[model samples]
Target: MKIEDWFQTLRSKAETIEEKWSDATEQERLQLADQLFYLRQVSDTVVDLWLQFEERLSIAIRRIKQMEGQLPVDDKHTQVAVTNETSDKDSSQSEVASAPLKKGKESTSELKEANPYDPVFRRGEGFYHLRMFQDAKKCFEELMQHAPDWESGRLYYAYSLLFCEEQEHAFREFRLLSRSASSPTVVASSFNAIGCILAEEQQWLEAAQAFKSSLEIKTDQEEARYNLALCYLKDGDAQEALDEIEKCLQKDEDDWESQMLWLRAAQLLQSMDESAELAPPSPIQLPTRDLDTDTLQEMASLYESVGNYHRAQICYHFLTERLPREGWAWHGLAWNTWLIAGTKRALTLMKKAISLAPDQDDFTFSYGWMQLFDGKIDEAVRAFRQMLEKNRENRLGQSGMISAYEKMGEYAAAKRMAKEFTEDQEPYVRSLGYFHLGRLAVVEENWRMAEQYFQRTLPHISQLREVPIYMQLCASKLGEQTSVKELLQPEL
Candidate 1:
């Protein structure tokens, strides 16, 4: 459909959805939310396509306001471009006619002008946007054959190669472009792309050099700096990593990834056991106390997610100084301290958090888990039971209770809870169930049963790093000569 028609259709559909939402049941409301999520994805994809459709018509899509959306078409933009091209052609033609033209150069220009690659290029781009990488690669491959000097076509071809898992070919092509591309922007991007590929292969030294080349070309290359810092960290230059990430934070202090990297670098520099393992950073606090509340909260949460509990505790400490009465700040601080320091000191903090926010289930759940972690079986079981009494559907409470049961040597109760968890809707929960079952089997010296349980877990959530470690332990018990050579992880 035309742009206007599409816009109107979207607006009408949005308004109808909004009108239905107020009166819809819970299930229907959830269905509507899914619909909106998919629609937003479609909108984002279309926006990306439009940004690449033409050089001048980039602002065709903009942010929504209230319930309305706008997509302005600049008709005059195309007209002006065509007019300027024609004027330039006429001027060039006159100059050529007046002067003694070099026939070879003229013929070369004519050959370029006559090349039938525009449609092929556009088709390749369409396939690229639709995520049909093989088809895009074929089209771009044809373009490369016919127009070998076309850098844009080569760039697209490289991207398609990467998308198609032909990373070696993509790396070679990008490296070529990085050294020989006419456009500064393309050259910088090529270097960055090369760095990413090398970084994935764990060639940190080469990757860092590539990123440095990208930075030399474009001084404001933030992504290159981020990549370079990661490379530096991996290459055993924690000080350089810290310095590079500091530059990123200087430009954008709210960059949570930069803060995480900064925290990581500091941790590495201070750690005695600086191997491949990701340990929490040292100094226990940030150098500056000038970060805003939201930035600090996000940094803390990010650190928590990545298991840098020490860094999270540091953020929470700063937060308590600013928002002492906030229960969540205390709760966050309490958990991280328990994780990094000890449960003894964290117990008082957990109590304070509970007192301030008695209604928060997370605080209750953590309090229970902390007790369980500290080997206070009776207290942990009671706390978990209390939480479940208030809300039986509490997944955390159920999980904690199961662990408590296992600790208390109540195999029957633990097995029952784990069986229920196996029937849970979420696959991750099912994996957890199997994991607990496997743990129980290990405890009972049922090696074969434990192996089967962990094998079942692999299909559900293979990415959980602990699953393999447990499996390896089980294997060793069964007298199978196996070793964990490497733990493969998705890189940043």
Candidate 2:
């Protein structure tokens, strides 16, 4: 059957089910709900696939735009022989495909080279976007055979697999990406996908954990948060479920899904309360206007420390209302914005913070990260450099510069910066330098060297989560017999 025919058939089936619903038996309606749920899941999964693929699509489109009029009369697509030698041949294909992976966007003129796989990707992506998952699966299978390492192709493949009901295969692909993808966005998306698969299997605890992990990697993903809330409800944590729903509502008060979840959570809580004889908590005065500035700041900082960014944001918002030009309040608010809304809006908020207090190293560093995640690598680098120039004692600035250098593929320059950091008088600063040096070594596939760097810094910076993570990653790569759980966390 043609892709259109099958898609239309599914639509026809849904229409028939809806038409019969008015007179259907309870059991029949349940069956219909199952079918509708499947369709809804497929739609949600494919939309996520397209969101991940959109970056590749935009890059491919830009490159094609730059290479206009240079195409051959016959733009024939051929399946290149898959082999170890393909790495060498990638240079002759799309320049974008061959470039070292980074989060930031590359300029089109810098990489306009064509590849046969680009055409295949466009075709697959087109089918994938149209809800023709079966045809999309075939196209992505071919793309995978051609370029197995491309995360975007793998994402589409996994998404199509889920729609095809190949749940096990989809889970494996998503799990792999979550564990090893270089980009945080890709890793977070993979974790969210894993959560969905686990949730479908009725493994509510595992699914909730996956969603939490996704949020830990990138807190601003609303879909993951919603899934986490649903999982909490399923896991019988009514109050926790309500908290997650409230966070979603904070983003969009009118969000129908969040409102529904909130209602469900409240009902669950009420049912539990009716059954249990719990004592009522003591009440306190609400929303006093006489709170001092320092008290408000402390409250915001305390909430921020506990991952209660919404509450922190509320306090910061109140502070901003009272102290319109205060950079500290704006800076705190900007960080929460990053956690709750992501880089697009956070970047603008951070710029306001930076402009108000050009002298605060904390604000400057925060602005640089906001810029970096927003894909403005050069601007982020400048912010980091400027902060370092203003005060050479600022270790965060040095670390930021090292990170930006690695993103830009300037390993030698990054190494130089790392070395300078190691020479810092402060042990904490030196630990950061060694930590970044370890990261650079890992990037170059020098597992043993990376392990040594990690070990040297572990005592000083083990408090920072990434130190143990890299140490475990290096240990695993060096053939050490260690539980891989420690790769993501220091413990189980």
lDDT top scorer = 1
lDDT of 2 by residue, 1-492 (tens): 996897798889889989999999999999999999998897778666775687577666555754684443243431222111112321211111111111111011111135557667766766765657798899889988987766667777887787677979989988988887666666777787788777766788998899989899989867678778888887779889877878877786545445545555655564444222222112211223356676567657645544557766877888888897989889988899899999887777788888898888899999888788778998898999898888886778978988899999999999998998888887877777888899999999999999888777855542444665677677778888654244333223
Cα lDDT tens digits for candidate 1, 374-471: 88888898888888899997887898988888888998889998988889888888888888898898889999999899877865443355766777
- Which ranges in model 2 have alpha carbons more than 4 Å from their true place? 1-292, 389-394, 481-492
lDDT of 2 at 20: 93
Collision pairs in model 1: 267-281
Q: How far is candidate 1 from the true structure (C-alpha RMSD, Å)?
A: 16.4
Against the true structure, what is each candidate's TM-score?
Answer: 0.50, 0.40
Model 2: pairs clashing at backbone N, Cα or C within 3 Å: none
lDDT score for residue 85 of model 2: 17
